[model samples]
Target: MTKAFASQGDLTEKKITFDEVGRDLWAFTAEGDPNSGVIIGDDSVMIVEAQATPRLAAKVIEKVREVTDKPISHVVLTHYHAVRVLGASAYGASQIVMSEAARAMVAERGQEDWDSEFQRFPRLFEGHESIPGLTWPTTTFNDRMTVYLGRRRVDIMRLGRAHTAGDAVIYVPDANVMFTGDIVEDHSACYCGDGHFHDWPGTLDRIRAFDLDAIAPGRGGALIGSDRVNGAIEATRDFVRSTYRPAARVALRGGTLREAWEAVRAECDPKFGDYAIYEHCLPFNVARAYDEALDIDTPRIWTAERDLAMWAALQG
Candidate 1:
């Protein structure tokens, strides 16, 4: 029998964990569900990634309230994925920030991504009706920008492309922690449907260069310490490389997409089958890898119609 399309069958709720990775930085993770970060600055707080919807974000808010009452001053989006940005409204922050490329993605394929993701992973969009609309960045920077929460400096930088073209990583200088949006995941699968596989390792290298003390990764538990941080970064690199190599080999040999799919499964499943969302991400990862290997510089847009068609073809 065919597997359920994407994560549609994943209806069970995951237990949430709010742990401090840095002095005042907290990671909100839910048993491999999409994770968000809380950076409590001198006078206010900065949320790293907004959950899929306001309802999901409210859970993050509740965790934040338990510790401090400082107002949320900024909501920084690491990229333009619907599951990452659609919940911006719930923050009530003065500024919503993104990289220049991320904002362009919002204008270009934001709605399509929203529709496609809602269909692919219904569990993440549990309170879909509460979404105000497509989340837009009120503030945007090209490469790097710094914000001061009353002397606590948070550096938001577009290190390099990995998870998405516009991926951003927020660094807390005082605490030596970084909120690496899907560019680094702790025991969670990297969703590579819109990734740049060739450049992903370079991006990982840039992140590794920091020798960060801690990291609040995209979709797993908080990573604290140099050893654990480096381990997660390398593990993500391994997952990306493992998924791309086999698919690239198939694509270069002029194999069909289905052939690439099987090749990727054979290579990745043994190592990553038990990872969170590994199966949900495998097909898209292979498709993107195949295209990239064929020298497709940019990823093709993923829509709901195209999603179903791709799934059907792979199944056949």
Candidate 2:
């Protein structure tokens, strides 16, 4: 209310890049905005991480058309975040997939997250009116499921919790490439508003163990080589560690939230100050980190009102 979430002021349109990360694997990235992955198989295509609205999803559709005429047979939601899953209808895919945990979160706090994210980043919800409603997965999996687009094998698994309790990763064995949701970011701030900070690093390790050749990360550019891919993974790990360590120290000492906030800032700013959405994500990240450090396992649902109240507290 005082100023606005930093992302609210980010109205500048980013340049979209539809890059080929692997053989028929494409990454639709728009600067540091949320990204989507396109996997073209023998008979059809699978989309990973739908955009915020039908209008935005149309942009990814346009890119998919440029390369393949195959029908979009599946839409895989890496998590239940509003920014990533609200554009489902646009795909018209026969199957929409999400982890059981992700679907449960949708039933529990999906609408609240939608309202909260829409308030935080107005630019992303440009075609909010076009969204039919909250996106729901027609198909759900417990821990792992293998969906094949013709002969192409895509393994969808919940590696560990980072961005949210329902976070999942889509691994394409042939390409040795993985589409990680917010579990890992490249030169972009990890939005921990609903994250599990302690479990995040181990998840990154699980991803790294695959020795991926490339990664279509949740945000930032598509990583195409071992060096760049591994760099992003380590950097993401460092960002989480840097953020939580200071906040955890403050919380362990029984300091106030504001004190934890200050402690986190002093540690993280030097490293991630210039990262995409850095300012927009910092308060929420610090708050969640402090709570998790204090042994709060599940992240509290973030609503529109909570967004404003948290911002006011940090700013004051």
* Candidate 1 Cα misplacement greater than 4 A, ranges: none
Checking candidate 1 for backbone clashes, the offending pairs are none
Candidate 1 RMSD to the correct structure = 0.8
- Per-residue lDDT tens digits for candidate 2, residues 1-316, read 4656658889999999999999999999998999999999999999999999999999999999999999999999999999999998999899999999999999999999999999999999978999999899999999999987788999999988898988899999999999998888999999987888889999999999999999999999999999999999999999999999999999999999999999988998999989999989999999999999989998998999998999989954
Which structure among the candidates has the greatest lDDT? 2
RMSD of every prediction: 0.8, 1.1
| Per-model CA lDDT versus the true structure | 0.92, 0.93
| TM-score per candidate, chains pooled | 0.99, 0.98
